[model samples]
Each structure stands twice: as structure tokens, then as C-alpha cells.
Target: MMAGMKFLSGKRSIFKVMGLICKKCALAIMVLALIAPFIATTQIILGDSKSDLEDAKKQQEDVQSKLEETKKYIEDLQGQVSDIQSYISSLDSQMETISSSLYELDLQVQDLEATIKTTEEELAKAEEDAKVQYEQMKLRIKFMYEHNDETYLGMLLNAEDMADLLSKAEYINQLSKYDREMLEKYKATIDYIAQTKADLEADKEELVNMQTNLQDQMSALSLLQSTKMTQLTNLNNTVAAEESYYSRLEAENEALEATTRQLEARIKAEEAAKSSVTSYDGGKFKWPTTSTRITSDYGDTDGRSAPHKGIDIGAVKVGVAGDPIYAAYDGKVVISTYSASAGNYIMIYHGDGLYTRYLHCSSLLVSVGDYVTKGQKIGLMGTTGNSTGVHLHFDVRLNGSYVSPWNYLSK
Candidate 1:
């Protein structure tokens, strides 16, 4: 009877222990089921956040590219405008010269016309004098022919003495000689006047032709100036339109940047509130990308008016994208978002107010609130936002102020 009671008690105890173990297992399973949904929901939220961030980054990149192109076009237009203006100025100078030449030509033409008029008047006077002289010579010849010729010859023949005949002959000879000399002088004067008039007409014709040619040239220059003016106006209008577009793009970029900054701040605040602080190992940080080749050094000017804030790590080969970007140090992710200037980026918060940032990522491997380790891949390198090419931009900050990442990076 004692053995039987002992066996039953031991069996009862074993059953109770097994039942307790089964109950505990059921409770543990229930708890896991309850927590799994939350984890799934959190993952979904993070995924959505990443998607939104990516979209914003893509929009920003497109706008930035267009803005840059517009600015460049504006610059080109401005150069063309300057060239046109210079051409117009040159035309003005040419027109001034043409005008001066035209004025001189007019004076020359006027002077030539006056000279021709004077020559014509002189020719007319010479013609009249020749006509008058010819009339006088004709009258003298007629008188001699009708009366003196016959009568004087008869008287000469009728003269009985040699002295009388000689006297009559001398008189007739003098009269004839005078008439011939007067006729010759009138003929020479008429010929000279005709030649002078002809020469004057030829010179006047030449001057008129020259004036016509000058007028045609002036018309051509005027037409060219008009065409240039039209082109300049069109260029000015185009430049104005481009400038307006550029201004709109600039405003949009500023707004995007502002929104990104706000989102980052909000995310940082939320992460700080939710996450437990992580301590840095006080060791040197690892390189953030696969390649150690520095495309740009910290504090170096990146072709901007300002100095660069971070160092850029390029891929092994130029123009290659999709390289892994690793965390520089172990820390909790404080910000995983997109920015117009930084693109798809993440900020890790190491305790004691230290932080690190990665920029221009193509895709993110980690999310906000995630704890990352040094050398752990967090994203992929890309040419996002305002980036020029595929690379990783790494920065370090202490108390919100940027510092050189080189200070903590391993050699």
C-alpha cells in the first residue's frame, strides 16, 4: 500500500510539471503572435517611408537638372545678346560713316552742278558772241560783194596812173583780210563752247550715278540694321522667359530643401525619443564605400562658390554606380530620408552628441531607428539630388556642426 501511494504521488507531480510546461509554451507562443503584427506593421511603415523618400529624391533630381540646363541656356542666350549688341554698335558706326560720306557726296554733287551751270552760261555767252561776230562778217562781205567789189575793181582798172591802182588794190586787200580773220575767230569760239558743254554733261552724269550708288548702299545698311534689331528683340524675349523659368525652379528647389530639412528634424527628434543611446567604440571609423579613392576631399571646393562639407568616395571605376555604402561607425540611425541637396541619405547618432551622415545613395539598406555597425552596408552609392556623379558623400558632425570625417577615419 505505501509503494502504491508513492508511485501515484510521483506520477501526479510529473503530470503537474508537464501541464505547467505546456501552459508556459502556449503563453510564450501567444505573446510572439501578438508582437509579430507590430513588427510587420512597423516594417510596412518603414517601407512606405523609404518609398516616399525615393520619390521626393527623384523629383528633386529632375528639377535640379532642368534648372541647371535652363541657367546654362540663359547664359548662352545672354552671350548671343551681347554679340548682337556689339554688332548693332558696329552697324551704328558704319551708318555714321555712311552718313558722313553721303553728306560729302551731296556737297560734291552740288558743287559739280554749280560748276556745270556756270560752264553752260559761259558756253551760251560764247555762242552768242560767235553768232554776233558771224553776222557782222556776213554783212561786211555782202556790202563788199554788192557795191565795193565790182565798183572798186572797175575803178582800179579805170585808173590811168600806177599810184592810184596800187592804192585801190591795198584797200581791197585790207578789207578782205579783216573779214576772214573775224570769221575764223567766231568758228573756233563756237567749237570750244560745244566741247566744254559736252564735258560738263558727262561729269554731271557721273556724279549722279555715284549718288545713286551711295543711296542704295545706305538702304542696304538700313535693312541689315533692321534685321539685327529684330533678332536682338527675339533674343531678349527668350532670355526673359528662360530667366522666369529659372526663377521658378529656384523657388521650387528652395521649398524642397526646406521640406527635407523639416522632415529630417522631425525624424531626428522622433528617433531620439524612441531609441536608446548607443555608445561609440572609440575606434577609428571604417571607409564608407567599397573604393577608398577619394574623388573629392573634405573642405575642398566642389565647383560651387562654397567649400564642400564632406569627402566624396568614388567607385573603383569612373561612371560606375551601385557600389555599397557602409556605415562609418556603430550607431542608431537617427535620420533615413531624402533631401534635395543630399539625396537619399542617412544620419547615424553615436552617443555623446556625435553623428555621421551618408549622402547621394541610390537605395537604402537600413531604416530609421535601426542600429548599424561599422563597415555594415547601409545604402548604395549614386548620383542623386545635386550630385555630379555616382559617389558617396560622407560627413561627420559633433553637436550639429560639421567636421572633417578624415579625423576619425582609418588610414
Candidate 2:
């Protein structure tokens, strides 16, 4: 309360008002006058304090608003990263297909070259045989032309008997028949070789055309692949650059809005989970992973800003990735999606407010609304999102809060 020495205008008015009352009032006035300066100072201090408090509250609100905005921005960036990765995968598939086609084309070209070599060899052999036949026919014709009528007349006059004369004439007729047959055979051979050469040239032309086509296609595919790779690289660079900024903002804003939202979502899921199942008759949950190695226990916050909500199972195998992640218990999947923090995570709702989570998965095998059995493979363990290494982060939420996996898992 603010106190003053005067009611109307001056300290005399305070004394006059008290005089009209009683001696008790006068005593009160005396006390009020003694403490008047202190009360006035206190009024100013109270006003300043209220203003300061309101200012502090406004600053807090502003900080909280900034935190939410920053979180939302980071989430958007994560989504963009996911989209770009999917595009990169698609481009990879296309490039593989192109490479396979190119490989096939290479094989065909090799076969064509082999066939052309064989054709040329066969063509050369036929031409050589035709030339030999031509030379033999020329010699025979020249010998017949030199002898001519003299040889035939000599054969007739020198004959001792009519039987010998007839035999000589028959021999001359047989020589004429041989000459005619050789000429016809040479003509046929020339025609067949000419046709074969023409066909071989056509095949060679076709092979050349095919190779030209393949080269053009390869050039186009190469250009497209180059463009796609550039896009992928740019996207990767953007993610790498923004991640640092995101971390800076995340460190400054201590609202933990993202964490709160996750908890809220789990809380909302509980109602739906309970409605779906009245109770869980299943005994102990199966181990969520093959590895029995526990890396991080629940509620442990060392090396991180926030407490760990689940158990992290390290890879105890030869490889880091592709380890099978199984369902802890039989339940219907309530949430199956990717997140900036959780990466590929799954939430399975068992009856009576019991839910399970698998985080940092390389791949998810089940979708929302799908029911899975205990020990069923749900995903492959991986180091995704905000993970440190290859591991399965298994979580159990009973009644909207994270619980210990040891309590649910069997020995």
C-alpha cells in the first residue's frame, strides 16, 4: 500500500482530518507521518519490481517462441535432406540400369566384330578360289586354241581301223563337254561370292549404325547422370552446412520443444493404445536385438544434453549395419516414420497403455496399423539421425512415460 502524509493537498490536511476523527485517529496519523517516506519509496520499488517481472516474463516468452521456430526450421531441413536422399537413390538406380544396357551393347559390339572378321576371311577365301578357277580355265582355253583343227584331223588320218577313229572322235567330244561345264561353274561361283560380299557389307553397315546409336545414348545418359550427381552433391553440401547452424540454435534454445512434442505424442498414443487392447497377457518382452550389449541405459544423460529415454544396444557382430531389430512384444504399429532425431523409428502399441519404440533403424519393415508378433524383425539397426554409432535404441513407454527395458526383457 502506498502511504502519504496528506489526503487533500498538504500535511496539515492530514492532521486536520485526523483531528476531526478522535485521539486514536490522531495517533494513527502520527504513525502514518513517521512512515510516509518509507511507504512512498516502497510504492516506487513495487512498481519497478512488477515492471521488471513483466519484462522478464516477456523475454522468456520471446525465447520460447524463438526455440519453437528454430526447431521447426531444423525439422524442415531434415525433411528436405530426406527428400534429396530419395532422389539420389532414384538416380543411382537409373545409372545402374544405364550401365547394364551399356554392358550389353559392348558385348553385342564384340560379337559383331568377331562375325565381321569371320565374314571377311570367308570372302577372301572365296575370291582366291574363284581366281584359281579362272586361271585354270584360261590355260585350258589357250591349249585348245593352239591345237585347233590340226589335232582333230591328225587323229582321224592316223587311225588304223574305223573302231579307233570312232574312239578318238568320242574323246574330242568329251573334252568339249568338260570346257562347257567349267565355264558354267565359274559363272555360278562368281555370282554366289558377289552376293555373299554384298550381304557381309550390309551386316557391317548395320553393326556400325548400332554402335553409333549406342554412343549417342551413352552420351545422353552420361550428361543426365552428371546433372543428377551435381544436384545430389549440392543437396549434400546444403545439409552439411545447415547442420552446424542447427546445432548452434539448438544449443542456445533450452526449451527442448522437440523432446516435449515427442513425449506429448506418446501421451496421446496411450489413450489409443489402451482402447485397442484391454490388457497385455504376454509375459516378458523378447530382446529387441540380437546383441546383448548395452551401451546406454535409460535416464543416463552423460555426453548428451538430454537424458536418454531408451536403452542403446551396440552391435556385437562382424558388421556395423544390417543387424535385425525385433519387436519386444506383439502389438499393432501406431507410428512408423522418420524424424530428425529418431531417424527411422517405429512405435508399436500393445494393449493397456504399453508401447514400444525402435529408433535409428536403417530401414523399417512395418507400417502404421500393421500388427506384428513378438521377436518379429521390424527393422535393421543403424546409426541414423542423431546417433553416435551403429546401435538399436529400444524404448518402452507405459502410460505415456519411458520405462526401463530391463524390466520388460527376459534373461
Candidate 3:
């Protein structure tokens, strides 16, 4: 009976040991199940953290690249501006030279005019003197003809002596010689006066031609100066726009870097806490304007010298101003201000690195940091800045690079 009790006690002890072992195994299994999930969650969080870090790093690189590119472009614009200024200065110098030449030419023309007037007076006097001398010569010739050779012969025959006849012949010969000499002298004077008048006229014609040429040159210079001035104005406007854009880009880069740092820190915290992450679904966006007709299509180079970066929506009455502009999606207003190139513009930041820009507005209805919903009125469309007509210039950006707005807008 004692041996039987010992056997039963030993069996009970074995059963207790098995039960303890089973309980330990179950506890280990439960712990393992919990630990496995924790490990998986940790892995997922780490993966998200890594991804966010990579995205931040990539964004930083992109910002740096854009900054470098903008700096280079600004330098290039500066050089162009300097060159244009120098060219304008050169043009000014040339105009000064032309002015000097024109002044001298005017003086020469005045002198020539004075000379011609004096010559004309001299010619008129010479003609009057010639006419009077001719009339006197003709009267003398008529007297000599009426007297004739018979009177000279009679005088010679009736002479008291040979000396008297010789004297009479000498008197007639002297009178005829005097009359011929006077007529020849008058004819020579008239010819000389005519030659002088012709020479003066020729000189005057040359001076007039020179004056006309100088005037033409002045006109050409004036036209060229006008063209250069216009070019300079355009260049100045472009520089102003580029400078504004550069400043905005710098601010954006700084903001992006700050956001990236914050994201990195947040990702680290999330990894430690194994927090949930939010994602964007990339939903379709609403049309930004009431008018559906596109005045300028995306990538169309019709009116633009380069590829158009965005689409332009015309007003309801076709080139009329003051149409309402709407937000394409729910977003926060990131920028709202006026620009020389974009006029009264607004930029919105939707989550997940998406952005939209509205340009050439006559008035703004929103401010920066204001939250806006899809189809909300944000501005009024009109021809401002670099626009030719009343329209809305709409743009979409993925990160900082421009993309087609059509990709996000509803058809």
C-alpha cells in the first residue's frame, strides 16, 4: 500500500512539472507574438524615417541646384545689363559727335548762303554797267557811220597842209579804237559776272545737299537711340523681374531647408514613437477660372519666343478684364504679392510638394497663410504685368519644377 502511494505521488509530481513547463512555453509564445509585432512596427517606422530623410536630402539638393542656377543667371543678366549700358553710352557719344558735325554743317550752309547773296548783288550791278556801256558804244558807232569815209576824205583834201591831214586821220582812228575797246570790255565783264553766278549756285547746291545729308544722319541717330532706349527699358524690366524671382527663390529655399530639417526631426521622433504617417492620394484638381476656353495652351510657342510654361485662360467676354480666379485645389496660400512679370500673383501650397501659381491678376482676394478650398475665389483676372490681354496665367509645380496643369485638372 505505501509503494502504491509513492507511485501515485511521483505521477502527480510529474504532472505538476509538465504543467509548469507548458505554462512557461505558453508565456514565451505570447511574449514572442508581442515582440514580433513590435519589431515589425519598428521596422516600418525606420523605413518611413529613412524615406523621409532621403526625400529631405533630395529636396535639399534640388534647392541648392536651383540656387546655383539662379545665381548664375543673375550674373549673366548683370553682364548683359552692363553691356547694354555701355552700348547706350557709346550711342550717346556718337550722337554728340553727330550733333557737332551738324552744327558745323549749319554754319557752313549759312556762310554759303551769305556768299550767294553777295554774288547775286554783284552780278546785278555788273549787268547794269554792261548794258549802259553797250548803249553808249552803239550811239558812237552810229555817229561814225553817219559821218562816213567821205567826210574823212573831204577833210584830208581840204587840209591846209600834210600835217593837218595826218592829225585828222589820227583823230578818227583813236575814236573808233576807243569805241571797240569799250564794247569788248563790257562783253568781258558780263561773261565774268555770269560765270561767278554759276559758281555760286553750284556751291549753294553742294551746301544744301550736305545739310540734307547731315539732317538725315541726325534722324538716323535719333531713331537708333530710340530703339536702344526701348531695349534698355525692356532689359531693366527683365532684370527687375529676375531679381524679384531670385529673392523669392532664396526665401523659398530657406523655407524648404527649414521644413526639411523639421521633417527630419519629426521623422526621428516618429521612428522612436512608431507614429502613423500621412500620405497624399494625388486627387484631381478643379479648374482655376470660370472660363474654360484656353487662350494660350500649355507648351504652345505661338506668341512666345520660348515654350509657354503655363496655360492662359481668357475672360468671359474675350479680352475683357475683371474675371474671378479660383483656387485649383485645397491649399495654403504660400505667396501673395505683385511682381513686374506676374503682376498681382498668388501661389498656393498643397500638401505632398504640389503647388499652383496664378498670375496677371488685377486684384488679389487672398493673403499668404490663408487656407483656401478648391474652387474658392482667390483673385481677379486682368491684363497686368507682362500680359498682352486680360487673362489668367495658371501654373502647376511639382516640388519647385513646373509641370503641366492639365495633368491635375479635370477634363
Q: All candidates' TM-scores? A: 0.53, 0.41, 0.52
Per-residue lDDT tens digits for candidate 1, residues 45-65, read: 121233445555565676687
Off by over 4 Å in 1: 1-48, 154-171, 273-411
Which candidate achieves the best TM-score against the true structure? Answer: 1
Q: Candidates' lDDT values, in order?
A: 0.72, 0.66, 0.70
lDDT, candidate 3, 170-278, per-residue tens: 9878977887887788778778877877887788788778767666656755665565566567656755765775675566567556655645654444333222213
Ranking by lDDT: 1, 3, 2
Worst 10 residues of 1 by lDDT: 39-48
Query: How far off is residue 390 in model 3, in Å?
Result: 40
lDDT of 2 at 244: 55
Candidate number achieving the greatest lDDT relative to the actual structure? 1
lDDT of 2 by residue, 228-288 (tens): 4554465456445445544544443333343344444544454455566567886899988
**lDDT for predicted candidate 1 compared with the true structure:** 0.72
